[model samples]
Target: MTEDDETALSRPQRRLLRRIYNGRTEPIVVEGLAFLTYKEASRYLLTLTEEAREAAYQEMKRQAG
Candidate 1:
């Protein structure tokens, strides 16, 4: 690696994702949506209330059982 290469690498392309989150690149299967990006998916997940989250968890558990 040279000075020129280092300079080029300094400017990194920003990803379309939440910087604070531990993210996955795969699609998130929500109620009726397949969110392609963690950014979009994370935002939608944040909007769901605690009751909605619990209901979803119960439904998933029931299906698995």
Candidate 2:
């Protein structure tokens, strides 16, 4: 991914990356969406449809404020 793509990820997305890559195995939930595994969630966050990505972004924004 480009630097701009990396920069575009939300705070929660970064946290998820850390959690997944650092060997955290628990599922994660965001905005009512349940991720059964970090890899699964990471995949969704990185390569899914725009609607899913936007939902994640909005959820992160909501949590931040």
Candidate 3:
């Protein structure tokens, strides 16, 4: 209810406006759909069978070196 209380809230609120998500980069954007989660994406892309998905999952984990 006081100016001091209002000013204190404004000070911290100013930071909320200044904070922008700057972690984006050109490499990821150029890759196209890099942000898309691989776990779900692969399921839609590969419809061979659950066995194939399991094999692909194993292969992905193996190749992640």
Candidate 4:
């Protein structure tokens, strides 16, 4: 993202982006749309089931370990 784009995101959004990026090596996609920014992905993440979130967390740990 450009400097202006980075500055446009709120602190929470920036933090969310960091967390999401840390968890995966690939862009998040939902229903065929690619989520390259926190604004686009946060809603989808918020809507995930607990089981799905846990699965994603496990995958992140697996990748980290």
Number of the top candidate by TM-score?
4
Candidate 1 lDDT, tens digit per residue, 1-65? 33453232112211212332235445545577765543454455445576774454344334323
RMSD of each candidate? 13.7, 5.5, 17.6, 7.9
Could you estimate the TM-score for every candidate? 0.37, 0.37, 0.32, 0.39
Candidate 1 ranges with C-alpha deviation above 4 Å: 1-26, 54-65
lDDT of 2 by residue, 1-65 (tens): 56565555667767755555455444456757666554555556777567878787456434434
Q: Identify the runs in model 4 with alpha carbons over 4 angstroms from their true place.
A: 23-27, 35-65
List the candidate numbers ranked by lDDT, top first: 2, 4, 1, 3
If the candidates were sorted by their TM-score against the true structure, best first, what order would they fall in? 4, 2, 1, 3
- Residue 51 displacement (Å), model 1: 3.5
Error of 1 at 5 (Å): 37
TM-score of 1: 0.37
Assess the local accuracy of residue 58 in candidate 2 as a C-alpha lDDT between 0 and 100. Answer: 56
Instruction: Tell how far residue 60 is off in model 3, in angstroms.
Output: 0.3
Clashing residue pairs found in predicted model 1? none
Clashes of each: 0, 0, 0, 0
